[model samples]
Target: MPIQPQAAKYKPESPILSLGEKIGDPVHAADFPKAILRFRNDRWAEAVGLDHLNDDQWVQHFGRFQPLEGTLQQPLALRYHGHQFRVYNPDIGDGRGFLFAQLRDHAGRLLDLGTKGSGQTPYSRFGDGRLTLKGGVREILATEMLEALGVNSSKTFSLVETGEDLIRGDEPSPTRSSVLVRLSHSHIRIGTFQRIALEQNSELMTRLVDYCLTNLLQPAPEGVAPPIALMRQAVENTAELAASFMVAGFVHGVLNSDNINITGESFDYGPWRFTPHWEPGFTAAYFDQTGLYAFGRQAEAIHWDVAQLAVSLRLLCEAEPLIAELEHFPALYQDSLITHFFRRIGLTPGEREASLQFIESCVQAMAQTGTEIDRFFFDWRCGDPRSPARYAGEAWDKVRMEAAAFLPAGTRDHPYWTDDAPCSMHIEEVEALWSAIADRDDWEPLNQKVEAIRRMGEAHQPRLT
Candidate 1:
């Protein structure tokens, strides 16, 4: 087995249960005709102390939802409510997924093993809980690409193709189905808090708030209220998430409260897309008719989403400090955007004013000159310390000249930097990759894409913020 062993041993815990019955209900995994393991993440498995399991053991635990030795005895289908594209839905939760297990990684940080297509619960409503195989594949691709690009995204821990044929309106009928397992910092979303606030359960809200501050963050400062401190941490995190997405050219299709993890890590990849260039109005989900969560508006969208989180927190404390924290989002996002933009282009933060001007100029240039997103960054890797110096010749010379003043932060020695073309994962290319899997059961293209993406990550040296 390929593994990246860490120093700390496996540690299991279920602190969410401390919130008790209000959060969720236990549910059994679906009975499938077959369980074929397609993807296994030994790197993360080792971190969580499951890398020792053989493939059969892996499928038994993940595919069949057998309880991990010391985790949740039964899967908990979490309950929460959220605004779906600005419309509130009180009856929305983990419809096709559930929290399967909770444990600490090698770094001693709490991580939840959640599912995407394991089965249905109270939230399934009118649909089958099965995830189409294509959807599973797409998620793997999305998470892999996002991680490679240095986005703090959920890890696609395992993907197993469960034998089943499901019908759907979105694509071809009777599509293949599968189950996906992901590892992330926390499953408690803003919607989770919103659900409590809706119930007007102040006691439970306080309990949940304490759970977050204790498990997700440190103790509140001497004078700081718990809600205010938690809100501040969340504000910084969500701002960083928005900045990472924008700089990576990612459009998260859905920016609902439920999809926003309170831990600030990006999760739930649906209707996601990478922009061809810097178009602020670009959208990922087709149903987003108003462009509420467009690429350019993501920072605003997250601010709005977190403000709702602050509203949820209002049930437990005074609104002034919470509102104050929400107000910090704009400055937090701009500073974070500038920070990540420099990291993305392999340069240091030269000077705040100069860096801001250069970034604005680059964004404007990319828009006016229609420069491809990855191409622009690829050409300037290590500020063209090596080959691939294909930046705009004269029109952008001043910007390039300014970039030269900053010391290089990323090395161009990786073989990937010498390639004729940058690693790209456009929708067109992804669909073509899926066609190969569907038509000929050829997995090489998808595998190759994952490898190439990892190589690109090696070249960029992605560091999670």
Candidate 2:
């Protein structure tokens, strides 16, 4: 076999240097696999400002950055059709997004550096091709928070505060828009193949499968089960993704085939949420009225989404084999759940029958009596041997009281718990203040919480064998 150029000179970077290079400099700071987009404005600027190019200088900026040194910067528009809310929307292709380049990081790992909100293309259709600044800001937060929460997520590269006026609802007025650039392993989605399948374009689908296997899933060796084998690999990827989301308490909000990826990594961030409580019914999408994408139903949603991807592949193969591959979801989810359940209780290494029973007890306790999810963990972090036992009194009253600071008082279950509910007004005010931390637009509070969570993660049992 021929050797690849970069691999020939491969020298593993010390983990410290690998991580340090991402912190570029003061003008720009890199966050691990992704970096921050320097803020600019032109709706879709001619330059990424990597060289600090002004508007007129962007054309020079464009050609020079064409193929970033280590990432795949191919400029081919990918094909895909998807069911948007159960209706066939067969006309999606990168739309306004493009994979600009791929590069290897200091870690010697190849990562894709793609830009979204970069403006229009042949697939732009009838849209502004501009992303709202608020959405851009939210995506940055979602990626940062989810990474800290230990989910396999796309890292935010640069959030260019492109100083262009754009109009959108959910905002007080027309606001300055932005172009968000992200870095990841791959941007290939299940919908990418789904598009070719819907066209009955098997040749294209085969090429797509080959491309993925060569680049992302080359584990099966050179001459494995052919293109169809990739279909099986894709199934496994989706299953693992569903399990990860379950463990992380993440609600993807949109499970459309196009939003799902063959690699099983969480890619797009939209209407997503990290649960504050363990309620199975919690939904991040205000519009997910059908409950198909609720917190508890995420695994099933992923299964259904993957099945839709299989439909495209089935045009050239039997359904039973693909369906069998899809069945791994439940078992995978169960194993992942039990493992996480133990960690939440601070138990690890040993797997006794009693451990399972204890986990079941905790789940039942939380279910029987509605408990604040974040508070349950916060109480565990209280550093008191008596902390867990306090929940035994007054039917879990102490747990509720300790959690009181974290939940909205009005949301408490008192018949008189109105806006004017009577209590130690000072305590009520304090709770209101701290609870609002989750709703803040600024990063100071969330940043502090992230640091604390990181400290906790450092002390946890190793996640891998």
RMSD of each: 2.1, 11.4
* TM-score versus the correct structure, for each prediction: 0.96, 0.71
For all candidates in order, the CA lDDT equals: 0.86, 0.54
- Tens-digit per-residue lDDT, 211-230, candidate 2: 67766665555554555577
Error of 2 at 431 (Å): 17
Deviation of model 2 at 96, angstroms:
3.1
Encode model 1's per-residue lDDT on 1-465: one tens digit a residue.
012236456788998899988889999999989999989878778888888889999999889989888789999999899998888999899999999999998867888999999888999999798899998888889888888888888989999999899999979988899999999888989999999999999999888889888987777889988889889999999999999998899999999999999988899887889999999899988889999999999998899999999999999888988998899998898898888888888888877888888788788777878888898888777665234254545647766777777887877788987788889888999899999989998989988898888778777774744
Model 2 residue runs over 4 Å out of place are: 1-77, 106-109, 221-224, 343-346, 349-360, 378-386, 393-465
